[model samples]
Target: MHKILVTGGAGFIGSNLSEELLRRNYKVRCLDNFATGHFKNIESLLANPNFELIVGDIRNIEDCQKAVDGVDYVLHEAALGSVPRSIKDPIMSNSVNVGGFLNMLVASRDAKVKRFIYAASSSTYGDSKTLPKVEDVIGKPLSPYAITKYVNELYADVFSKTYGLECIGLRYFNVFGRRQDPNGAYAAVIPLFVKQFMNHESPVINGDGEYSRDFTYVDNVIQMNILAMTTSNSDALNTVYNTAYGERTTLNQLVHSLKEILAEFDPEIGNVDIKYGSNRAGDIPHSLASIDKAKNLLGYNPEYSLRKGLEEAIKWYWENI
Candidate 1:
C-alpha cells in the first residue's frame, strides 16, 4: 500500500483529505503544528491503524524532512491563509506560506516521493476581470497571500524542472464543508454565515452582495487531489489544475440559499437578517473557475453543486456546532 504524508493534516481541508485517504486504505501520516489546525479535527482518526500523526510545523525543514521520510507521496497543505491576515502580518504569512512551502518542496524532492500534490489558491487569479478564469491567464497579485500562493506555483515548477520531482498543484476555489471552523476571525464565508444564522444573528455581506465565487465543495477537492496523486498520464504532471465546481454564486444568492437550507432545521433561522458593509480589501468582484482542464486531464467530475454541498455542510454544522 502507498504511504502518503499530509502536511497540515489537522486543518479542515487537510483533515478531510486525510480521512478520505485513510478510507481508501492508504497509509496516512499527518504532520501539523496546531498553529491554525486543531487536534479535534483529526481526533476521530487517531484510532485508525493506518493513520499516524506527527506534531510538527512545515516552517521547520527538519520537521518536513521527518514527515516525508518513508512516504510515497506528499500532500502539502500547510499555509497561513486569509488575505486580510496576510495584510496584517505579511512577514508571518510569508514565513509559513512561502518559506514553509520551499521546505516541503525540498524535502519531497530529497525523499524521492512518487508525486507531490499541493493546495494552490484561486486568489492567484487576483485583480483579473476575466470571467471563467483559465489556467494560463493571470494578473498581478492583489494581496500578500495571493503573491505567496503564486510563488508556490513558481517554486513547484522550478523544483520539477531542476530536481526532476513530480509535482501537481490544485488551485482550490473557495472550498468549504465539514469541520470548517466558523468561530475564527478568518473564518470562511459559508461556515461563518452558517454559525451566525444558527445563533440568530445577522450575517454581514462585505460588499453590495454582488461578489460571486466558484465555491467548491471539499469532496471535489479530495477527488482532485487523489487524481493528481494517482494519474498515470505523463502530460498531466508538473502543472496546476483548478479544483472547483465550475459554478458561481453571488453573496446575495449565497445568503438566501443558506437561510433556505438552515430554515429546514430551525424555522427561526429563516428570519435572520443580512447586513451589508464596505467591500473588503484585496477581494475581487467576481471569482469563477474554468474546470475544463481538470475535467479533461484528471477526469474530475465534481459531485456537489453549491446547494448540495451547502446542505451537507449545514447538516454537519447543525449536529456538531
Candidate 2:
C-alpha cells in the first residue's frame, strides 16, 4: 500500500481527499496545524487504522519534514486561502502559501517522494479577460493570494528541474462541496449563500450579479489529485492542470439555483431575498476554466455539475448544520 502524506488534511478539500484515499485503502497520514482546519473535519477518520493525523504546520520546515518522512506521495494543501484575507494580511498569507510551500517542496525532494501533487487555485488566472482559461496563458496577479499560488507553480517547476522532484499543480476553480465551512468571514459563495438562505437572511451579491465562475465540485478535484499522483504518462508530469467542471455560472444564476434546490427541503428558503453590494476588490468579472488538458491527460471526467454538486452539498449542510 502506498503511504501518502496530506498536508492541511483537516481542511474541507484536504479532509475529503484523505477520506477517499483511505476508502481506496491507501495509508494516509494527515498533517495539519488546525490554523484554518477543524478537527471535526477529520474526526470520523480517526478510528481508521490506515489514517494518521500529524498536528503540525507547513510553515515549519521540521513539521513538513516529519510529515513527508517515508511517505510515497505528498498532497500539499496547507495554504491560507482567501483573496480578501490575503489582501488584509499578505505577510501571513505569503508565510504559509509561499514559504510553507517551499518547505514542502524541499522536504518532498529530500524524502525522495514518488510524486508531489498540490492544490493550486484558479485565482492564478488573475486579471485576464480571456474566456475559457487555458493552461499556458496567464495574466498579472490581481491579489496577494493569486501571487502566492502563481509562485507555487513557479517553485514547483524549479524543483522539478533542479532536484528531479516530480510535481503536479491542480489549479482548482471555485471548488465547493460537503464540509465546506459556511460560517467564516472568508466563506466561499456557495456555502455562504446556502447558510444565509437557511437562516432566512438575504444573501448579498458583490457585483451586479454578472460575475461568473467555473465552480468545480470537490469530487472532481479529488479525481484530479488521484490521477496526478498515479498517472504513468511521463509527459503529464511537472506541470499544472486546470481542475474544474468547465462551465460557468453567474452569481445570479447560482443564487437562483441554490434557492430552487434548498427550497425543496424548506419551502420558506425560497422566500429569502438577495441583496446587491459593491464589487469586491481583486475580483474579476468572469472566471472559467478549460478542462480539456485535464480530460485528455488525466482522464478526468467530472461527476458533478453546479446543480448536482449543490444538491449534494445542501443535503450535507441540511443534515449536519
What TM-score does candidate 1 get on C-alpha atoms?
A: 0.99
> Backbone clashes per model, in order?
0, 0
Candidate 2's residue-wise lDDT over 178-283, tens digit each? 9999988999998999999999999999989998999988998999999999999998999999999999999999999999999999999988989999999999
lDDT of each prediction vs. the true structure? 0.95, 0.94
Give per-residue lDDT, candidate 1, residue 173.
97
Candidate 2 achieves a global lDDT of: 0.94
Candidate 1 — which pairs collide? Answer: none
Off by over 4 Å in 1: none
TM-score of 2: 0.99
Model 2 clash tally? 0
Clash pairs, candidate 2, are none
